[model samples]
Target: MERELKLTVATERWNSAEEWKELKGYAKTFMLLMLLSMTFVILIGIGSYMRHEISAKQTTYGLATVDIKQSALQGMLAEELPYYASNQKLDTFSLSSLGLWLLEKVTNVSLLDPASLVASEMLYSSVEEQSTLIHGGEGSDPAIAPQDDKNMSLAPIDDEYLDELLAEVGNDNSSEPDEVPVAPEQEEEPAQPQGVESAAKPVAFIYHTHNRESWNSETSNDDAQSTKNNITLVGQRLAEELEKHGLGAMVSDTDYPTAVPDYEWEYSYKYSRKTVKEAIASNDELQYVFDLHRDSQARKYTTAEINGESYAQVYFIIGQRNPNWKENEAFALKIHEKLEEQYPGLSRGIWGKNANSGNAEYNQTLSSQSVLIEVGGIDNTLEESYRTAKALADVIAQIHQSEG
Candidate 1:
């Protein structure tokens, strides 16, 4: 009986020990899980604090003090975020742009649209002070205080002088001391004069999808948009100038904002596609299509000095969404090469755009010869743009004539 009692006691002891072991294991697991949860919460708090601090400082100091000197980063940002790239030299830095850039960097996602962001309005109240300079208002004082954009518009030039300037530009040998720098051969034989009649049916079409896009000097209100003095005028000028080169050209006047029943700016290319189709159907002779736009960059990047005159530079945009985009790029390269030879520093290299960046196709599939050209920036004046139009006409004419 004593032996039986001892065995029962031993069994009870073993059972107690086993229960203790299981309890210890549970404690260890709970401790590990609690530790992990605490670490995660701490990390999240730190990240939120850092983001808040950085944003606060950026708001107060305008990121200008950051002095981002990395060219590769700048180029990449410019390529990806068009607004941040374009407003590099603004008097007041844009807050939304800075936030978007940081967000994109941290998230590793592309942010291409800038129109949706609330941006600081850049003002050019001291344009008169800038006009006195030689480089078409580039290098203007950044110290000018930002003001409300009310009644800001391009100062009118003397009409007689403008006519004389156009005439000199058209003349083969007319003595203008600062004539457009041309290739050695072109200097001997100037471009065909500006009013030559072309009997062939209109083979080139020039149109503006963003017809209301206006320069700082072109608008008279808070927004840089206008009904009359806008990009359409540039398209019109290009068409008339192309006609002077014996290439019949037509310009579109379809104002999408009013013409479309429910117009959305994002669907601008859709409206323009309809216009291009109609033009093609009506005129089978159309061989080339040109879409003209003004860049949103600063004056320093968009203005070029040639022969003591400031000419608004050109940027060729080829739509990568088109299956035959390479063909259009090749055609653009031909024009770009001619511009480089004739008007050095006028072409700002060719860039390709896709849906992530913009309307990917840009209606380029319509024709291999189709191209989109950015003539200048917001700060460029009408006269500077006109000179660029004339130069483009000269180069395009030479190319067309050679092909024939």
Candidate 2:
């Protein structure tokens, strides 16, 4: 077993001296590439194993480390993104950087687009309208006449919407809560003898249902005002004009709306009704009660150019639900007819709305001579509304002069 034959055949076929010199360079380069490839594979495997281990540990122990790390990463991105965007040139490919760049572009585009501004305005107006519809605090009178989507003409009012506004009425109609009666329906009254007038006595009582309705003429051509400085001032001017025409007028500046615990529109008329009753009962000379209001329509709908002067268009609203609506209707027709004859385009035609359609009686049941007058629109300026009021005073005075 220890005997071994010694062989002496030496062979250099595998690596001859000349071949080794030439092959060494290629062999060295191949070995280096292989080493690098193996090292990369090994590192990838290690990383995968580490992730698995971390996931397993989290599953077993319910550790918050991953969540905390995610939060930290998001916070870091949020905090660093602006700095990187402002300071550094964002030429590198990164997901967070791309997102930030896109957001900035979108912001810039929104600022440049005029439609975006219009969209924002529409949104704001819609929000305001819905809020008023819900709260019953329509200081701008938007619900009084909504925009007509179809024809863009003067839109008829929604009565059901107006009916909901009655929530503002107080418990003054009856001592018992249930005793308040709906305005009773009666036969239309015959026209009374015309030309009934008393000398040197106030015959007209003018008041505002929405005294807070204002105009934004100082700021913009559009109507966006809602301060106390609007419609109430027009009423004052109208009262003055009435006196000049020999028609004594009592104008009320009562902010009865402030007494409302909430935006109670129903109570608005009821509260004003109390004021009306007190006026009529206290003064036997008061013959006509006018509930002056501002129309919420657009400028074109409420404005009229008459004899090179601008005036707000006027409308006479008749409540057919009241028992004495015929009397009110007759008087309103007379006024409307008279105005049409003199002022022409200043009149916007008469509108009749019943309880089935809007506020029903609209406190018209309280008196036979009650009339609801809408003067101008939201876009109408104080000067325009005042001019119409002056013209109105003239018309009423002429009617009064014709009285017996």
- Any idea how many clashes model 1 has? 1
Candidate 2 lDDT over 81-156, as tens digits, reads: 8864566443344567445444333221134344543432331232111111111111222223322112212334
User: After best superposition, candidate 1 residue 355: deviation in angstroms?
Assistant: 2.2
Q: Candidate 1, residues 74-100: lDDT per residue as tens digits?
A: 655676687988877433335566665
Clashes of 2: 12
- List the global CA lDDT of all models: 0.65, 0.60
Q: What shift in Å separates residue 274 of candidate 1 from its native position after superposition?
A: 0.6
Best by TM-score: 1
Give the Å shift of residue 315 in candidate 1. Answer: 0.7
TM, every model: 0.53, 0.51
Best by lDDT: 1
